[model samples]
Target chain A: MEKPVSTSPLGQTLAVSGVSHSYAGAQAVDDVNFVVPAGSIAAILGPSGCGKSTMLRIVCGLLRPGVGKVMIGDRDVTDVPARERKVGMVFQNYALFPHMTVAENIAYGLSGLPREERRERVAQMMSIVRLEPFANRLPRQMSGGQQQRVAVARALAPRPALLLLDEPFAALDRSLRADLQFEFVQLQRSLGITAIIVTHDQEEAQSVAEQLIVMNKGRVEQSGPPAELYDKPANLFVNGFVGHASLLKATVARADDGNGLLRLASGSQLAMPGPVGFVPTSDVVLAVRPEHVKLAASPTPGALLAKRVLSVPLGHLMVHDLLVEGATPVRAIADRASESAELPRDVFVSFALDRCRLFPAP
Target chain B: MNRNGLPFLLPMLALSLAGFVLPLALLGVFSFVDTSGSPTLANYQRLFADPFVLSVLVDTIALGFKVVALTTLIALPITLLYWHASPALRRVIVFLTLLPMLTSNVVRTFAWIVILGRQGPISQALVELGLAPAPRSLLFNETALVVVLAQIELPLLVLPVMAVIARSDGALSAAAQTLGAGPWRILVTVLLPMMAPGFLAGWVLVFAGATTSYVTQSVIGGARLIYLPQFVYREVGVLFQWPSAAAVAFVLLAATSLIMLAMTAAARHPRLAGHA
Candidate 1:
């Protein structure tokens, strides 16, 4: 592959500090801050209208922050116009100029270079995206996946300090989205470019991003590695937004040295290892992933009583939606031990205590 | 689909055949016959033979082109302003642009007469500002005709261009800016090409309307200048020559149609044809 167009050879760090912007009387992004290390990928994951889009615009200099600083590679670009910021952005629709050919669109940012040099750079970018065969095709004539690659090629041709994409895979079908996301990760890895993709999909975020920043109601709920955030979410919002989990209301019945006893609302008492930070008789919520819950064939001493409401059998596993304590619903996924044997409606559910987490009640 | 649509299309087709095509056919036949009712090509031959008629024909077509160019230049900034304006301000702009069209064309053309007359506001202002030695009439001139005609055509161009701007993908310009294109470069490369289809449609409307606008030409241009429409009027009404008037009318129609075709073809050239 040809050398990456970035000037630093290695990508530069992107730092956004204390950035807060409001529209009219409503807050859009409130004191949001984060850093993506050089040559790494960060995903800003949030639901629609949660201010991730606003943060992406602010970082790329398209919309100036109402209050704060944006630094790329140690250069403070808070006051710079978007054209002079040396940042490349791929818009949600890909926004390829309908009038220009693929070669012209890719060369749009290289206007300052000599003619021969610009042509060479356009060729290089097309080659990087595996689009040399479609250089003359208009964006309307290409498929969604090909158009996305063209947008990436056009943005990277400028050799910008940082790359930002807004909902990069939101326009593709499920099968195509997976393939393009894989290509994007491989391409970013080969170029060693620092990039940020804003998306509302948690699965897409978890699969493609090294660092995942989850935002809610215009504030950062949590920012960490995907595995870290999924495994140890900071609060109720993060716990619910990052991945699937069952949160059961409970109270601390007793506290000891680095270990605790909890009384679940279902009238069951269990011992859990701590660093559980609450005092005795404090209200808390216990969070457990579906994969961590298993069905007990018969009632055991440590198991809790529950009735299976519904069972969906996939070829590889059966997903059971169970009501714990006869009221609160919890989901569990288990291997389909046999194809024809059906489990009893009345069974006990047990947790893998080491994988479960507890959070103080709201 | 054809069977389903034909019933809905009957009224418009009958109206066009009666109102437009039949009259044009009559005019064509009138151009072929002489005063004595002998079938002769003298009416057409006589037209090409006259220097005055040729100049008048040339001037009217040139006048149409000038009005189209001026209205396009004037409509762009208004479209841009409307694009950036708030919702309330946009409503106000639409009201102001359409307000003139609600008035009669004769009234609007006469208002231009009051503005450009010898004792009108413009001449008085010019004399007071010491730009002119005396109050001079700006009416009865080609410049006055072009300006007044462009004013009449302004709304035709502005509305369509505004609609195109509204339908445009705003992200394209934002994307261009992030690609390091300045405002002027983005306008030239991205925005203008996208607006071409609307502009071309507006051009056809303005060019056709302005060239045939006999009221504005006669009121603002006066008898001091003679365009093809005025020439045709003089032939039939003043000199009582029906054949000659019919010939001039047909020539005007052919010339206007030819120019519009050429303009459409040129606009469809590879560069501007991207969106068109």
Candidate 2:
């Protein structure tokens, strides 16, 4: 297939509003609504079977929403069929046509264009994915990463308004996954095309996307910038899913103007701002990220006593598991350093008050 | 074969030798022998010189082609349906498709005789619908034989195709759809090429079964249609020329196997799949 005419690299905003879908009467995607700004990479992150893939399919028009609509740029395309939707998809398995060559696979969707133009477009797409040297190779003859790039090139050759990837790097190894993720992010930014990747790996999502959507069960848990979702989760599920965090049980022992003296299970009272929808003496859970737990040799006013259990060193990050007297384990992460090698058996750990999220029991 | 599998295969090997190999060897010997048990090629020579035998041979080949065509036409769509059918519907379809295989061919042919004979349901329907001037026999015709043989061999044509479609995981069609191809183009370009192996297998199975079939030809076709298998039956039963019958049977077997070999070779050819 030849190359298509050089269209504008600028992409359009994709809006999925009031979208919900069910399979065999069980909900798969529930009332999902999110707007992805044009030319930005967005990632929908969730565990397996958490409806992240379902949401991507609906946005690509692969699966029709039971209710609400989808819009690409300013056009309402909810009623449009998958072929007419102009949204491209790279499947989890790369689904390149087994019988077609690299160039032919890229040219499949470009049949509407002239033959020479389609061929030229295929060549350009191959070079964009750095697959020009393997233009005649079958998908089976290429490596996983090469096949993945071919799939991406095939999806992009038609100049679709929006692109969807379902677990794009799942079939790759850990090292190859990161490399391809980096390449994909770079290519997407250079092309200035809207991309929505569905993955269960939060690190991959965070590394590749500017906007992140965390989903659970059949609903969106949170949708915002990756940093915001990591720093300030809206709920317990998001807090546990997006990053490593330990949730501790607590209750408000005293309440004052916009503040509460929360008592931990260890019987230590830490004064913090009062949480919404809860009164004094109400049981609550506090989400404290590992990085926020500061360790000290001596007991501080608001610190809790814990015995060090084990420490794991990986790259620059060191994770220490410390157990309280009542058998509750609290994990803290600190950067590895020369001076931080030896640790006391008994250490005082204080939670960063601003970094913790106080919430009711899920 | 492993030790355990070797034991399991003993029964099949013994049965094939007793049932297939021994009989084939005997048939070969008898084809070149005279009534006095002396070896001679006179039987084969006389069999080939008869124009009637040639016509029957051509008709049987033509019938093999028609049977394959009709079975494929009826079975391919049904196979696709079974591939995508719901669990409950799939079970019912599988059971229905295998119903003809349960009974012996002789019994099924007897039932077909009653149905395609005069005053049968079809003739009655034709009379009631005024499609025919009056109720008459629909039996003993090429159309009747084709429909009956297709029904008999339909499962053979469908099961292989169903297996292929099941393993494909709907990936090719989904890819085609995402690539802007409509349902028709996907069916033509993606599906048919991939299912070529199943199509060839089913065609060969049905062709061989229908070509060697004797009960259906004798019962439904009666004396009107002189097919190869019927000619062999007559040479042995009526004319008492067992040598000539054996010679004709050998030729039929050789032709069927040769055609199957050619068909398989063509099906596996890479160029057929657009894999340039």
Candidate 3:
């Protein structure tokens, strides 16, 4: 079905700049700045109480920032009231009105329209969410996923300029959450809505976002494509937050011609990549992805031998924890298909030099 | 189950059966009986024929509805105030609102009479301010009865409505505002629908209580405005007519029950259920 052409013009860009907010003298969001491009999904990934939701509220005009401005397209809506902002939101709990039926809930936001138009729009939204069969049922009568769909339909009924979702699938079970994630992605694509979602689950954020902003303690630690952030983190926090990794303490032994040797605490020396910009004798922490480390039967040159402490099977992969030369344990993900003939208690672990990132020790 | 537990529950069940169900059943039986020295329908016949009895019954029903309407009108703002108020302010407001209900109904009725009677505080204040020539009497009127009845039942109306509003998720209203609903529209379209059940419960309760109340009505309205309860009291106590008084009591009981039944049915209707 064709949506009514937006006569007010479309593709409004939202920019939040230098926004800071506090509650009772404790900062909740501090100097956070990011721009959501027109017709793209921006996911804010953070731990609980990291002020991602506070930032979303600020952008949606629900809360005013202490210092900074929010601009949508050309209008500075920092002080505008929430009702006039035309920003639709889907709450974490779905927040569908339990007292209203599916159709009534959908029509609630369109109350300004003519009665006949409101009815038509509600029918249109019900079909969009594929809830026509349960349109007359109250929210309490529907399942969790169905209620979530109704909430989305209700928020989208008015063709809001910017759509905000606060952990929209947090209440759903794993299977339902995955299915709704795909459905939401497809719906967002079809509607071309510029949307922002705040979630603590990294995988969920990575799956739905075109660009991910990793937030920590009321600040943006890093922002980039999910793959880029996972492959090349800008800081120690993003390195651990984006995916599973093992950190190893190491010191640069010698440096010459843009290449150096890193000495581990276990008295093992490994060749470092030339691109790692660090001086000789400098201490740095090495971040290595679990999948990057490989187990070999025989010791290759420059490879370190370690005793396998335990092998935990996780579906198709076995994660082996190894004690390297009596030092701290390191973990590697070995494919179960290839590790079927495993019989060795000791193994050599090695990784390509380019796979490791070096950060200065605190 | 323990035998000792059975003894506790048995007495409660027996008391409820005797104190409540038995009285209602007796009233129903008396509603169909006669009192003209024979097993005829003369009592019920006389009840329907007397214009004075019919007028008093109508007046009672009308006053019941009037009190319910006024109570709801007063309680809506108070409930909203309690809902959005700061915690400390809410505590104080709630305490003050309930202060009236905690007092004896007879005492509150007398307080209203003192304020509304001729040469009373309100009448004297009006006279001194030249709002009226002398102390004008405001008591012994339907308006005074309704006002006093509403004051007595205001807490009943406010508590339930405020409880519903307080427990509401609040997220739905926030979502409505984000969807472009102003405060007024959000109240009417979202908050009110969610709170309809509590409002209906309060209205029915106050209406039932006001229809059956005698103290407030008798004290404020006096003998001039004869409600159904006062009429029944006059028949039984003043005229010493027991059978006729029983017949009038049965009529009032049936009317109040039917009104409550209709309200319950309306509340359960699909159209209203959709909103609530």
Candidate that would win on lDDT:
1
Please give, for residues B169-233, the per-residue lDDT of candidate 1 as tens digits.
Answer: 66998999999889999889998888887788789889998988999999899887888888988
Tens digits of per-residue lDDT, candidate 2, B1-276, equal 458778889999999999999999999999999999999999878878989888888889889999999998998788767755877988888888888899988888888888988889999998899899988898989889988998898889887777666655466677788788998898787777667777888888999999988889767787889888888888889999888999999988888889999887876665333331
lDDT of each: 0.88, 0.85, 0.85
Model 2 per-residue lDDT tens digits across residues A1-362: 53343462347899988989999999998998999999999999999989987887777777788998999999998888887777889998988777678898899988888788888889899989998899888777789999999999998988988889989999999999999998998999898999999999999999999999888988988999999998888989998989888888888887756776888887878888454346888899988889988888788887888899998997888899988655678899888884254779898888887778877886
- What does TM-score give for chain A of every model? 0.93, 0.94, 0.94
As a whole number from 0 to 100, the lDDT of residue A288 in candidate 1 is 88
Which regions of candidate 3 are displaced past 4 Å? A1-5, A23-26, A97-101, A111-124, A246-288, A292-311, A320-332, A342-362, B1-11, B30-38, B82-104, B107-128, B132-138, B271-276
Which run of 10 residues does model 1 chain A get worst, by summed lDDT? Answer: A1-10
What are the runs in model 1 whose C-alpha is more than 4 Å off? A1-10, A249-276, A279-283, A296-310, A313-315, A322-327, A337-340, A344-348, B1-3, B83-95, B117-124, B127-137, B236-240, B267-276
Better of 2 and 3 by DockQ: 3
Candidate 2, lDDT over the whole model: 0.85
Candidate 1 has an fnat equal to: 0.76
Query: Which ranges of candidate 2 are over 4 A from the true structure?
Result: A1-10, A22-25, A257-259, A266-268, A271-278, A295-302, A305-310, A338-348, B1-11, B33-40, B83-92, B237-240, B271-276
TM-score pick, better of 1 and 3: 1
